[model samples]
Target chain A: MAESRRPLPRPTPETQHFWDGTRERELRLQRCDACSQVYFPPRPFCPACASRKVSVFAASGRGTLYSYVINHRAPPGSGFEPPYSIAVVELDEGPRMMTNIVGVPQTPEALQLDMPVEAVYEDFTDQITLPFFRPLEAS
Target chain B: MRPGSVAIVGAAETTELGRIPDQSQLQLHADAALNTLADAGLTPADVDGVATAGESPTGVAHYLGITPTWVDGTAVGGCSFMLHVRHAAAAINEGFCKTVLITHGESGRSRIGRGGFSRPAASLQGQFEAPFGTMGAPSTFTIPVLRYMKKYGVTEEQLAMVAVVQREWAARNPRASYRDPIDVDDVLSSDMIAYPFRKLMCCLVTDGGGALILTSAERARDFPQRPVYVIGTGESVETPMVSQMEDFTTSRAFRVSGRAAFEEAGIAHGDVDHLMIYDAFAHLPLYGLEDLGFVGRGEAADFVEERNTAEGGKLPLNTNGGGLSYMHSGMYGMYALQESVRQLRGTAPAQVKDARISIAHGVGGMFAASGTIVLSNEAR
Candidate 1:
């Protein structure tokens, strides 16, 4: 397979655990011990209470498609093909994440808002795994 | 202090509007500043305060030979200049400085000596928004439009009317980059950049700059040109990422900023003779109208479709064709302010007949930040 030229995420001291969880096919979020607030884009302190007493916990990878746009133009030097879907997936955990909707045609007709979705780990590099979302199949 | 306490005494754009390959970004700022200073019949030494964005305020001051006592470099986004005008007013009121000069220049199309702003891979947008292949403003900004359309039943035709009406205004502007007449069909037929947003719906990419000089209302008449009084100003910020916007249907920043400005100005919505909403995309005006309380929720798109914002409408918007049809040099708030000043001065090429009160509202990032300036020819 041609090496994916998509930009990869770099783990920082504050975001290492989140990436490590992604590497293990899990979506991790931080919950505040004081305010009981859950947040994404992990940080050491709770944005609500400014409390550092927070813990990272795995979340249910299931989410719903809040909104999205089908990009017809790929940015200059971006390796991704045109007509890819960029989406905002609202996790059942009450936080929204920016991700790509995969396993479906990148068309508005095919992509419906409020559709149930589940996270899929996409590896841009061997050491990096990013979470993408796809429509959950009916049982 | 009340907002009308300050006034804009001078305003000018770079000598040329579109595509100037010869000048660097800094040179564009200097060109605009020199033109504005000349319009006000003042030299750089007369400026006691300076503010700018996309470039350093210190650099602008040094280049313009302005040893300002107060300086602000609030690089919020396109709306940075609006916030600067507000901040300059506050500083002037508090006696921090007088005769403030706010400038903006961007070689967006030419990319000459433009600074880079690549976020660290671990940054919020980088780790969250960027990894999803969200491209430039065009792609990322589409997320809200899609949701807004679905919720409000705003048709593609209603959205296209924004560009169509703005182009009508641009046709009358000699300096507008694209003066050719276009309709909803033309906008719809244009190349699809992102789903629902065509090439015509997006703002032009051009190399240009604009500057404004503001002072207290007491010293306004000393300038060469008729001063445009700043009656009201407001600013607020949301999330930097478009996807993370609190509500895709409306911009919270626009509401907060617009409401504050309206309250401060003490002007009824109907009293606004002219309006300028920074239209980076066609949907922006819809959001601005609804959020600013000009029209009720979900009514802006239809209001626009009915020609409520066109040339002879109840409110004339984007008199300089806005960013959509006019020159958008990255930070577009300055250009919008320039139009407001022109309308109030009775000197705009496509002048609104007897236009007195003009509102210039701007969005910084992808609904991330906003600033509103309510201006009038008459001082309260």
Candidate 2:
């Protein structure tokens, strides 16, 4: 079998570390050695300080929902499904991530603005996994 | 840097807005491109530079049967072509080419019903966001609009004013999709797509093509008719993905580009007699109002609610109905420039009285890129 000819994003040189770290079920963040600004989508330099001296570090993977939308339309591709919760999450590391909001009903009636959520990595393949979020219970 | 004057010497539109069953995507682009050349009294040989985004240009290049000296296929966002137009002007000024042609076409209204090309930035948005029933534009844009309401003390009635005003402009044009008169009550009472934005608040997708011919001031003066000078133009890009945006309430990209355009044109924002802003949604103008320094933060609601953007109001916005009512093939910004050219030419049926100086704005990928072009009657 050709592994069902799945539609998975192939990591490029610009984003290899991000994919590799995700495979091992860890959230790696790129930090600017100059300004110490932690960022996502691994790049060559710091966005804030424009320093080339950047390093990767493990993140706590804890963040809160900044904003979200429920897409009722289906995206292109075989594995795609509709009515998903696409969200903008503000990580504790001061970086905002764009990911899906899960483990809750995808509805305008259910989704609340600025709600608390946490990241959990799901292994989809031996070489790939994704960091998805679930609702955090009230402390 | 100051560039030579550029005029919208030619402009044209396709048959329908939302969907056209009989035509291919390339056919739409070809029809408009060829028609615009005919309108300007030029041929394929006259165009040495071509710029476009949205779809690949292999077919368009083949259909037109003319190779370009410089061709830009940068696909940043819907307004990426607007950024391309600015680059085209720079190319013309440097003598890279004489006549630059800009065009866009899409079968979105037909092929996918509500489809979009594979956007590079959208991957920043996960597929998991869909199963939760994400309503696309309603979820992405309306959320920030809600934050606007909370911060600015703007009422729903104020937001409705944008839709009402555009409807008035759309009604004047025979080709507008939402041309029927819709009152403030109708706008307010329409079903909510996202909490803050209602049905009437969003733009309609139309299957069509739009393009323009831009030339140097001297070359334009030698042509058949008057040449509208591009006094000043500026562009800026922020976080391409919405997730990377620092603040939803403020558009930093708009603010930066607005300043550059104003400074380059040597004109105050208040000096603009006519305005043509991208209206992917009726609420989009509020972003322009604040970004252009037309109103203070959160004051856009009240400013628009007072009907300041209406046809007879101080600012006559989107005379050809805008993307909300006109055409949203891919890059609505190209049409924004075209509509302003019409109004300045006194050809717009909904033309503002004695309209001269105009401002055209384009919002690229997910509100990511912004470009402002100032058009005037005389060469600056």
Candidate closest to the true structure, highest lDDT? 1
Please estimate how well model 2 matches the true structure, expressed as its whole-model Cα lDDT.
Answer: 0.72
Error of 2 at B350 (Å): 0.9
Clashing pairs in 1: none
Per-residue lDDT of A1-139 in model 1, one digit per residue for the tens? 2246776777889999988998899999999999999987788999889999999999999999998878898855787788988899999998888999998888888799999999988766767888989899832
Candidate 1 deviant stretches above 4 angstroms:
A75-77
Native contacts, share recovered per candidate: 0.79, 0.18
- The TM-scores, one per candidate, come to 0.97, 0.86
Tens-place lDDT per residue, model 1, B1-380, is 47689999999999998898999999999999999999999899999999999889999999989998999999889999999999999999999999999998899999898986686777788878887788888888778887888899999988899999999999999999999999889999999988878899999999999999999999998877998999999999998888778788999999999999999999999999999999999999999999999999999998988898998999899988988998898889999999999999999999999998999999998899999999999978
Worst 10 residues of 1 chain A by lDDT: A1-10
| Per-model lDDT | 0.90, 0.72
Query: RMSD to native for every prediction?
Result: 1.5, 4.0
Highest DockQ model number: 1
- Model 1, position B266: C-alpha lDDT score: 92
Using TM-score as the measure, the top candidate is: 1
